[model samples]
Structures are given as structure tokens and as C-alpha cells.
Target: MNIRLLAFSFLISASCFSQGEPFRRVNEFYLKGDTRVIGNTILSEHATKVYVRPKGLNDRTEMVYIDIDADSETFSSSNASLDIPEGAKIKYAGLYWAATYPGAKGKQKTRGNRIVYDVKNKRDRPFDLVKLSFPGSNGYTQVQGEVIYDGMRDEIIELKNAAPYVCYSDITDLLVSKNAASGSFTLANVIALEGYMYGGSSAGWMLYLIYEDETEPLQYFTGYHGFSFIKPENTQELSFKNFRAVERGDVKTSVTLAALEGDLILHGDGVSVFKEDTEEYIPLKSRVRYANNFFNSSITINDQKYTDRIPANLNTLGFDLAQVQIPNKNNEVISNDAKQVKLQFKTESDRLFVFFSAFQTEISTDYYQRVVVEGKPDTIIKPAQEKIAEEIQQKETTSQENVQLYGKDGERIVNSRNAALAEMLKVPALRVPGMNSGYYVVNHVFSKRNYALKWKEKMQLKGFSPVRFVNPANNYHYIYLDYSKDPDALYERLLEYRKLKDLKEAWILKVNLD
Candidate 1:
């Protein structure tokens, strides 16, 4: 199979307002126990309200907040953990609170049920809203729909980038919980704030951020600038929505990210992240060898490698699930194509459990094989244009439930890749444009029959978290709740599941395509 590698340079030059900075008056919405981030344009729901503790030390921050205009007086609610550039940090941080409707006239103050207190020095801190401003001289800021945040979020956040300096709200997992986490499968876009030290001038990157809906404007000046306007000796080009690693064995692994087709190749000596475009190659990680690769250092499990490369290595992948990132921001895999993924692992601590879950992921097929030990069911008894009614009628079975559903959307086939089969079976069949169907055997163990309903009940509560049911014999132990309602909630739910399942085997797996 030919793999495609798209060409993009992280070291692109940026300009503040080569064009006019569109106004995105995003200081409008508020949330209770919800969080916001620079990269994430949309605010998210959270059980814990993120507040700033003014007396924060080091990287440990208080409730982070952002004002559309760094100079704006009034502000909206934001979290305390924003990744602000060192230069931008003054003696005090910005803050925002909910406007209370003092009278029927619509005046407001920050009074709501959700109160976030991760930060310290609470009472001393005033209601301030921080503003994330990109140096106009940064790089290209794509004008997207109305969005206040710029991170990689699916569902809630609009897809297209509205500004050059968009933020990736990494808080989804923090607020909504694991199962509700929305964007986890995409390669992350490396967004940073560049200072004059870099090649760009003060006329910083200026792009507009659409807020709430696409029609409303949020913040202005969007584009990711490198830290410290100055170029470090080891500056490398980083792409945001790049790739996601799915399955790996020692060295050679499988990835579900998009294909650039002709530009790059992926190679890692287990220590460094290497990227090559058309003609040249660059070492993305040199000093930071053992990057907590594929997993972070926080939860290190037994590291293993099939390809014995000198000394076995364990590289950390920057952020950790344990670390409290901003809440409710969608930061999933940033792939060129759209595919779904889940948190197979939170960190290396969840390693062995991950392998067990993998077995479950591919379980339906194995289950089907076990169930249909007699032989393959009569899928296509006769000729082409087989009507689903005919298939069912031909079968001695009675209903959609009886025929043995296999995949998501209540299909009969077991293989998810062949989801189209369910549609094809219908009488006046409704068809999904680009789909096919797959089938698998099942070993319905009657002894454990009650397990099925228990699983179904759990799933019912999960709100249809997308799942594929196998044939009659194979059933699930726990039902995946429908997390689509809230990405943050989804992530938290996933975490809860991990806890319930005693799952702490590995970090979320990340396969590279190169």
C-alpha cells in the first residue's frame, strides 16, 4: 500500500495583519464548571471549575482566562491553566467571571454553581480575563468560520480554522471525563506564541476567532507563533493536525492518520522523532531522547520492543493524562482524513490493560468465528442484487434482533469495515454513499446470558456510545455510553471505565505513518 505524506513546514514566516484583522467580538458566552483554552475556541462543561490562584508558582497555574483583545477591559470566563508565552506573562494574570443579571435590565457578576479552585490566592485575585494575542508577523492564519478558539475539536468546535492564532483546547479530557473526550484521534498541531526574538516583527499574527456559532466573532489575531520570537539552535517544523499511531509492534507499526502520499517517511530509533519531507530530513527530537514516545513518563509500564535497537528506549509524549489541562477543549488526532479513535491507554501505567482491551476491540470477529463454528452463515445464497428482505425471508430467522446484529448502527455484519451490509439487506434498502459490509462468527455462551443484559444496561446509560454488536453468541461485558453529548464528559467517562476495568496498562497508543 502506498502511504501519502503531506508537506508542511513549521518554520513558516508569519505576519500580523497583511490583511485587515476581522473583529470577532467573542466576549459573550459563559459556562458553569466549564473550561476554556487558547487553542479551543469553544467553552466546555466541567465538574471542576478552573479558577486562577494568583500566587501560582512555576508552571503550576491558577484559573486561566482569556480576553479577545489583550487590551479589552471586560472579559469572559476562562480557565487558569492557559499556556501563555513567558513574555506575555506580567506580574499579574487576566481573569473573567460570569455577568450576573443584577436587575431585569441585564447587568451581571460572576455568580454560578460551578466554582473552579485549582489555583491559589483566590480572594486576592480580581475578576480578570486574559487575552491570547499572536504576533501579526507569525505565520499564515486561515480565516475560518466564527470560532473563538483554534484547537482541534470534533463535533462542538467548527472544523475550519477561523484565525491564525487559534488555540487547541486540551481541557476536554479534564472536564467532560474520558468517554466524552471529543478529539483524541487527530495529530496535534504544535501551537506556540512567538516573540520578537524570532524572525517576525511586533505587528504580530492577526487572525479572527469566531465564537459560540460560526456567525459570531470571538477573538482577533489568530496564528501559532514559536516561543520567544527568536529561533533556537534546534528549531524544527511542527505540524498540528498530523498523525495518530494506532497499533505498533516493536518498530513497524500501523497508523490510522491521513496520507500526504508523496512527501514524508517516519522513522524513530526509539529515542528521537524523525520527519523527512521531499528532499531533506530533520530530527524532530534530539535533546529530548526517550521522549516518553507514544506514552508519557508519568505512568511508565514495562517497556518492550521487538526490534532490539541498541538500548531499549522509552520516549515521553509531552502531556500527561494526570496533569490537569484546560477543561473541555477538543484536542484529538489531527489527521488529514477523518477517522475515529479512543483512549486505548491513559499512560504507560495502563499498559497490560490496554492489550486486554485490544483483544476486546477485535473480540467480535473472534467471537463470531467461535459462534458460527458450524460454518459461515448463508450470506449470499443466490445471485446479484440480493434484496435484504429476501436474505432475511430466505433465512429461517425472524427479526433485526434475531438475525444477530454485528456492527455500529445496529447492523447484521460483524466486521465494522463492512457497515454497508446492514443497509444493503433492507428491502427498499437505504444506502450510505461509500460503504461495504463484513461478517463474523459468534459463540453465544448461554451460561453467561445475563451478562448480555448487564452490558446492555450499561450501554443504555452510555447513551449509544458507538459500538458494533456481533452475532447471537458474542456479547459485551460493559456497554460504552454515548459520549457524543459532551466530549469532555466522554473523556471522563472513558477514564471512569478504565478505573472500573482495572485498566492501567499503557499510554494512549500513537502509531506513526511518517
Candidate 2:
């Protein structure tokens, strides 16, 4: 009986060691001699200035020094706005912003670069590329390349029919290589690219390389997650183990990989050596090798820590699935959407990540699933979006009703008064020297504050108005008012407030006065 039991235990141990995800990834490499520095040949002719980027300890330290040409008065910092001219060397430190709303104050930059991207074209804000894969229920991404810097030399003076084409994200499968001499590169999942990309060990972010005829691979993993290439000498002494647990649905950090037929290994601090799931910590061998056909398998959670005990089949109850909502520019409402190109996950993404490509928001967290489960469709929000759209339409109708041609109120704000002005907006009557009119400023009148004088004063502290008007239907205010006949002044004054406000139901009325 004892001998039979011991044999059965060995079989179970063998089975346990074989169960887990298949190691289907490869290590990408970089070739020597590919980093190119812009030299003096271009500097004397079309070039204005150049940046001497220095190597770094942890991060890079780039020195930007620029000079303008005789034909260009639009130089860096030469304008009061410091709107740098084309080809001017500058460092993108990121954007700066302060909230005009109460209790809202922040400068977002844990991911990087929120600055207004300097560009001549109104349409093309640059974007990073990646390879997108549909992981069963939703889409997962593999980084294609590092940030592609759009240089000034790559611009055109003028074009015909170059209607502002927005730079949007799309899946790419370009041949990424390091040195184009040796054909030592592997086809990567996603390769960042411009026209001709040359990636190497440049002491920068070497994520992935696009493929060309003659290119090589560089470092496999940048800093995300991946297994290291194993040498034959270390195969004997190197330890192998199993059963390290992390969050269930978390993506395995590395994307660019080549699977060694059944011989896959995880390395670094991310090894399956010390398991970190909910249990008494049971450390495994620092590394593990696949036994037989056990390479491609799965680990079922026989038990769970923070939930009720059950028969051990996974379940998701009372969790919000359709939490993501994006602003519908046309409807004036936020809608649950995935990519218009994609089927699902677009709506959930607005709540998941702030501005995609790792720029996260404070409103909600990225979803963490221990197990992937597709739940019932969210029919609730379908009608909700329509209701909000109808409400917005009704509000627009109501606002137009308030539109009267100077009524007894003497140019009183139809929506009442809470106002502030943007740089685009200005005091209209202030444009004319001797214009005698009631140019009262109301501040952020539509703010939740009780439209009190004290609160208005506080609003004024933030460069807003204090005087009151019929507070707009939503959280908006009449920033400026002028019955002046100065067409250019009055017209320009209202331009700032002309953009659609959050309160789509509100309207600007030419108040009817007796």
C-alpha cells in the first residue's frame, strides 16, 4: 500500500510540473555600427541648428541649441510666445496646465510629454506604433518602436489638398533591424518607424526595430518583461522551478519574442522562482524546463484567497464591465466605445487608460483580471447615451428659446452669468477706447458655488469674473458682453466663447431690450 501511494505521488508531481503557459517567444538582438549622428554637411545648407545629445547615467541629457536663418524671423524664443521656428532644436519637457475649476489642480506626467506638440500642420500630432493582437475577448498590444521624432527636414513648404489628416494609431508589421549589413534580425511583433529607422545600443529606449532587407536585432527586452537567452554552459548548474503567481490577466510584459522549441525560460527578478500569490510562500527552483508535452498548458486556481469558498470554477459577480466612456464630440455626451475600427474594448479603454500609450488618468484604474470572463452586454448604457443625447438636444432647444434681441434686461445673459475668458476670448467693449457699455465680468459663474459675491471674488483670483448673470445651463458663464457696433471688436470678442461648451443645452442670446 505504501509503495503504491508513493508511485501515485510521483505521477501527480510530474503532472504539476508540466502545467503552465507555453513559452512561445524569442530574444531580439542588436547589431553593431548603426547609430548615425547628423554632421556638418547638412548644417551649412538647409539646417539651422543642431542638438548635441550626451550619453546619460539613468536618463539621457540632450542639449538643444538652435539658430534661425535670414529668411526666418520665426525663431525659438524670439517670439513672445516662444513658438519655436521650424528646425529649431528644443527639448520636449512636457505640457503645463492649471485648472480653472474648483478643487481641480494637477500637472499630469507620470508617462511623459503632455506639452502642446509644436507643429505647422494642425492635423499631424505624432504617434508611436505597435502590433495589435486580439487576445480572445479584447485587444492587446506589443510595442513596435520608440518615440519617432518628426524632424523639420521632413516637411514640405506647401501642399495641395493636404486637408488636416490626424495621426491615428494603427497596427504595423515593419521589418525592424539594428545594422542593415548583417541579416541577423528576427521579425518583431511591433516595430517603431519613420521612413528609414536605424536602431542600435544607443543608450536610449531600444524597444523594437523595423525590418529591412539587411538589419539585425538588438537587446530583447527594454525594461518591460521577458526571458533571457540561455547559454549552453549554464544549462546544468542553472536551477529550474515552477508555480509563481501574479495577477491572472496581467499581460506577460514582453512582446517581441522567439520561442525556442519547447525550451523556454523566464529570468531576472521576474523569474517564477519565488511565487507571490495568496498562499504560504513556496519558493520554486529559480528556473524550470519543460518535461514532455507539458510546454503549452495552464495553471488552474484550485483555491482563492479573498473571496467566498466555492467549487473552484472562476466567476465575476458585481464588477463594472462597461466603465469606460469617451467624449462624443458630436453628441456632447461620453459614450462607451472601443476603437471605431475595433468591435469592443474601446469604450472600456476610456476609463482604463487616460490618453492611451501609457498616459494614465486619475479617474479609474487599469483593469486587473485574475481570469478573463465575458459578461452580459451592457444594454443599460445604450439607452443612457440616447437619453443624454436627447437631453442635450432639449437643452439646445431651450437655449435658443432664450435668444431675444436685447430685451428689458439690457444685454443680460440669457443663461445667467458665470464667466471667464480664454486667450482666444477677450472683453469686446475693451476693444474700443470710448465705448460706454456695461462690460461686467461674472467669473466662473456656472461653478457649483451659490453664485455669491464672495465666491465670485474667489473666481476672480483665478483670472475670472465676479459680477453675475443668468448662470448658463451647465457649468459655464458669460465671460464678456458688448452691444458695441464695432464689428471686428464684437466679433472677435465672442470668438473665444464660440466653441461648443460642456452644456450643449445652453445658448448665447442677443437679449431683447425695450
Candidate 3:
């Protein structure tokens, strides 16, 4: 094997044997590169819907296959619905499905007087493909998904008889092609183990939709997928950051979680959020969810229950899906200014496997802004020459005739016939090919020239008329409010700019032009 492959195999083997560590991060999706500065570039409002195929025979029994498609003899199907707001643009859509498959059926073995089933003798098969039918479609379309996590390899040793696996598919293009955002969708042929197993058998699917609306506030949306087995001895915690919340507005933050193998009758499992100030973990609860039994197989958002799926069971036997708003009127757990938060999942008796989690929260408008120049529409004119003239005129009006004046760097200069101050006010021309070493008060950086120009125009509209940008060897355009050779002056200017609420994150960039 190759060197990288050998290393990965060793790591997996070591993790399987480790008794203390039970949770692992398998995959993460988020905004990357300079696009992160746009704030709302990847930010959007989102909605989550879930349904289960092969639902339980009863509230207490294990999961069983109940095919919703009566006409199809070979396919097993289930259905769910999607409700999106009118006129909202869909940004991304991801479909996720997970199941515990212990292989095909066979005759039971006679051990002494008892009939013992040998699950190890069965062949292992992981399903990486499923069929999806859009609303009003006549037939099912095959969707090939990438495996996010598969525990089948560790089944006999670690996961027992429940060889759980999760798969994810980016269905954004497929949804966009249909131009239908809200309708009944069907999923079929999800291969999973039925009948009885060591742990309870379960299978289900969930759809996450992220959309953009002009009326909605800018918000950060992030999703993570992995297979983590949580039991009485082990707990899972996920930390989120890189987004700031609005302090004054009606801040709304929510989280969606999906898991399998949680029994309906079992208790002593809950989810909590870590509060930094009090150094305590606050248990999350809703109208249907309790602090002790948070993962009891229910589909709920905020305090409202969702009953728009085929065979919508109050108790899903082993599947659980929940979306709850944080710091609601009843539960004031998190603050508005919290930049980071950690979610912890724990269970005292039940053994559950968590696969997917997503978070969404409103952000400050200062994260991104477009400055419109006063009285100028659709264009930005250079104010460098005008600003220079204005500065010289102001100095001449404020000082005594022929009096010595000081530059921004505290250098004294004699005002010889009003020419000294004008010379001092002239802007320096930087060399294109040579290094122009200086300190810059940068507000933003963009990889594209067009984005930099647009930002510069916006800054000009906001009365920062002398805003300048420079392109160095790194090829990224650095937009700055001021530039100076003196480090002290640059530091002072940076402090002043940072005082503005919108520019609190503004910083200094030391460019070694040489």
C-alpha cells in the first residue's frame, strides 16, 4: 500500500481499540477562501424536513418495512413533504440517509436447546445508492451518494450487530432543475436490515434546504456529518465559531440534529449547550422534547410538531430528528453576543448513534456593507486630487502666515509661500514592480479585482473618499483606509477606525515592499 494509505489504516485501527474516545469528526462543510469576508456570502435561512422508511410496527416494537409504493413490486418506498417560503432563492440542498444493515437473512443455528442467530456469518453490504422522486414525478430517479461514515468494517468488534452507515448527496442541482421548492418527495429502495438485531434496527432520511431571502437578516449556516456512537460512558461535543451575532436585533439561532438507535421506552439521554459565562451546560428542551429524553424519535421545530410525512409516528421507535430554537421566550440559555458555542450530547442508559448536525443564526449587518456615495449614483469618481487640495487649504486657513507647520509624522516644515503644505499633502505614487514597504490600515481583502473595486466605491460613498487598494506579489487586493511609512501613525489610525462599530475587526497590514 501507499504511505498515506498505510498511515490511515493504522490510525483507524488504533481508534477502534481505544476505549476512552468514541466520537470522531468525519466530514465538515463550510465557506472557504476570501469569500468568507462577504459575511452573507454563505449565510442564508434554512429549513429541515425528515421521514423514516421501514417504520416501526408499533411504538414499542422494533422497526419494520412498510412500503408506501404499492405499485412497485421490487421497491420499498417512503414519502415526505417540503415547505419553503415564497420568492426565496434556494442556495443549497443536501439529502442524507442512514441505516443499520447486518447482511441478508438465513436459517437460525441450533446451539444446545436455544436457537442462536449467527450475524457474523452473513455477507456485509453497504448501500451507497438510493432512488429519489420529485413532486409530481412519474418515476424514481437514481441518486448516487458519497459515504460519509461506515461502521460496517468495525461491526463485529465495535458496533455489535448494528453496522450503521450514513451517506450524503448534494441535490441542489436536481432541485433547481425542477423549479419546484415545496412539494411531496418520495424516497425508495433504501437497503437496510429489518426484523431483529442485537441493538434496535432503524432507517431514516432527512433533507436540509438553505435559502436566501432579501427580507430576511443575514445569517450564518453550517452543517456537519459523521457517525458517532454515544452511550452512557461516552459523550459527543461539537464546537462552532467564525460568525458573530447581532447584539441589538431579535437574534434567532437554531440547531438541527439527527440520530439512530434511540429506543422509545428508554430514557436518560439529553442534549445541552455550553455557556461560557456561567461555565455550565444548559439542557435543551421543547414542547415535545424533555431534558431527560431529548432524542425520543420525534420531528419538531421550535415548539411546533411536524406531521406531514408518510406514517408520521409520534414515536419513531429508533429514529430521532429535532430542530429547536435557542434562547426562546421560555428557554433563555445563550446570549446574543456569543461568538462561539459548543453542543454536547450525552446518554445515561440508551445507546444512540449521531450522524448529522446543523446550526443557523442571525448575524450583524456590519459584517458586510455597501457604501453609496452621496449625490452620486451608479459610479465612483476619484477624490484623491480634491482631498489633497482641501487639506492644504484647511492648513493655510488654520495656521499663522509663514508659520512652520508639522506633517502627520511630526516633521517640522517651513511654509515657504504656501508651497510646503501642498507638497506635504501630495499622495505618493507606489512603484508597480518594486517593493513599496509601508503599514496599511486594511478594511477588507478580495481575490478578485472587481470585488475590490466595488468595495472601494462603497467606502468612498461612506465618506472614506481617499480609500486605496494595492496588489502585491501575493495577487490579493488589499483595501485600506490609510497607509503611512510611520508605524505610530498607522497604529493610531487603526485604533480610530476600529472604534467604528462596523469596522471593529479592521486591522493593520505590514507590507514589506522590498
TM-score of each: 0.16, 0.15, 0.60
**Winner by lDDT between candidate 3 and candidate 2:** 3
Clashes of each: 143, 51, 3
Q: List per-candidate RMSD values in Å.
A: 25.7, 29.8, 14.8
| TM-score, ranked from best to worst | 3, 1, 2
Clashing residue pairs found in predicted model 3: 373-461, 435-513, 436-513
lDDT for predicted candidate 3 compared with the true structure = 0.55
Please give the range of 10 consecutive residues that has the lowest summed lDDT in model 3: 1-10
Better of 2 and 3 by TM-score: 3
The residue-by-residue lDDT of candidate 2 on 70-171, one tens digit each, is: 323211110001111223222111110000011111121233543221122232322233222221212223433332122122243210111111111212
Task: Identify the candidate with maximal TM-score.
Answer: 3
Task: Tell me the tens digit of each residue's lDDT in model 3 across 267-355.
Answer: 68777877653367888888888888776656566577666766565555565666666654311344444467676667787665655
lDDT of 3 at 238: 61
Candidate 1 has its poorest 10 consecutive residues by lDDT at 352-361
Which of the predicted structures, 1 or 2, would earn the higher lDDT when compared with the native? 1
Q: Name the candidate that leads on lDDT.
A: 3
User: Please, what are the lDDT tens digits per residue for candidate 1 over residues 166-278?
Assistant: 22122222222222122111111122211111111000011111112223211111122211111112222222221111111111111111001110111121111222111
